[model samples]
Target: MKNVIITGTSRGIGFEMVKLFSEAGHNVLALSRNSKPVSDLKLKNVTALEFDIANEPEVVNLSAYLQKAMKTVDVLINNAGFLVNKPFAEITAEEFKRSYGVNVFGVASLIKTALPFMKTDGHVVNISSMGGIQGSVKFPGLSAYSSSKGAVITLTELLAEEYKETGPSFNVLALGSVQTEMLEEAFPGFKAPLSATEMAEYILDFSLSGNKFYNGKILQVSSTTP
Candidate 1:
């Protein structure tokens, strides 16, 4: 079973992914700003660590902790992200910086730290959004978030090409509106857009296959039945 590192595991999709992967018999290193609530599902092969993803020191400390624990990360899931819903014209510098701080810089920092521990046949999955895709549009207030996701997609593609000769694969999962706390925070008073469990299941299945078809591509999943 693969040893995977997932960020933003305190709740929502990241939390569900930890459960899904651990239940699949994989070792999971779950990271978040807060400790995950105690649960039977978190016992055994799943270990949770609390750290601010936006902080460079915390990311470095986490990397060192994993190394000291003699854990090799076979898969790195850059899942920690944030959304700021405000019109582009009204978005403040602080808002834009915070958006990129978590979505882009934090993800890059974790990947850099984990790359050394990753085996030749390892994998890296960056959790992006459908908003990153070309021509994809969202609520007018989501300019900053959408832009950051777009950057993620670009980073994924560049990394995939850079690691083409390596045995490991790099991919981006451009998720459709998934029901998570982030969604609720972004659009208050709105119903869930998609079930987190269903999306997590699909992601787990895709990750286990170790296929290259999705490499450097955006894989979008939606619950909306057409």
Candidate 2:
């Protein structure tokens, strides 16, 4: 069984992933700001951690846990995201900072902390959004959120190149609209074609095998735009 670390595991896709990976007999470290949901499940081989990527102390705590509990890292899925839907003109500097803090900087921090424990066959999957793709459907209120995701795409490519001689392949996924609580919060009354479990299954499969075929690539996993 592989040792997998998945962020944003409180609900939605991340929550579903915890189940899928656990059922597949993988050791999963599920991290989220509120990890009670997964903690409540009390699944075998799954550790629910109350984590906030934007918090430095929490990142350090995660590093300690990884070093102490999990000797090696097999799969690290940066599924945590932060979105602020506000008009561009009305967007505040702090809002953009917070978005970037979680969506971009937080991801980089985790990778740095986890890289030491990752081997050549390890995989790092960073999750982005379809709206982050340039020239895709642009939404007015997501300037901060989408742009931050775009940054993650570029970051993934750079890391892959830097680690070419090393190990741990990195890839990013620009997902299309998935019917998640985040989507519901962003756009109420809008129904997405794919459910959380459906997307989770796809992601679980990819996180395990996608690295063999592609690295430093961005896969668009959405059939519809939100």
Q: Candidate 1, residues 1-226: lDDT per residue as tens digits?
A: 8888888888888888898887789988888887645243546688888778889999888867887874687788888888988779998999999999999989888888888887667888898887877776565887888889889989988987887777467888888777788888887776755688877787777776644465676776654410
lDDT of 2 by residue, 1-226 (tens): 9999999999999999999999999999999999899999999999998899998778977878898999999999999998888899998999999999999999999999999999999999999999888889998899999999999999999999999778799999999989899989988898999999999999999999999999999999988775
- List the candidate 2 regions with Cα displacement exceeding 4 Å: none
Residue 94, model 2: lDDT of 95
lDDT of each: 0.80, 0.94
RMSD of each: 2.2, 0.9
In angstroms, how far off is 174's CA in candidate 1?
Answer: 0.7
User: Candidate 1: global Cα-lDDT?
Assistant: 0.80
Candidate 2 to truth, TM: 0.98
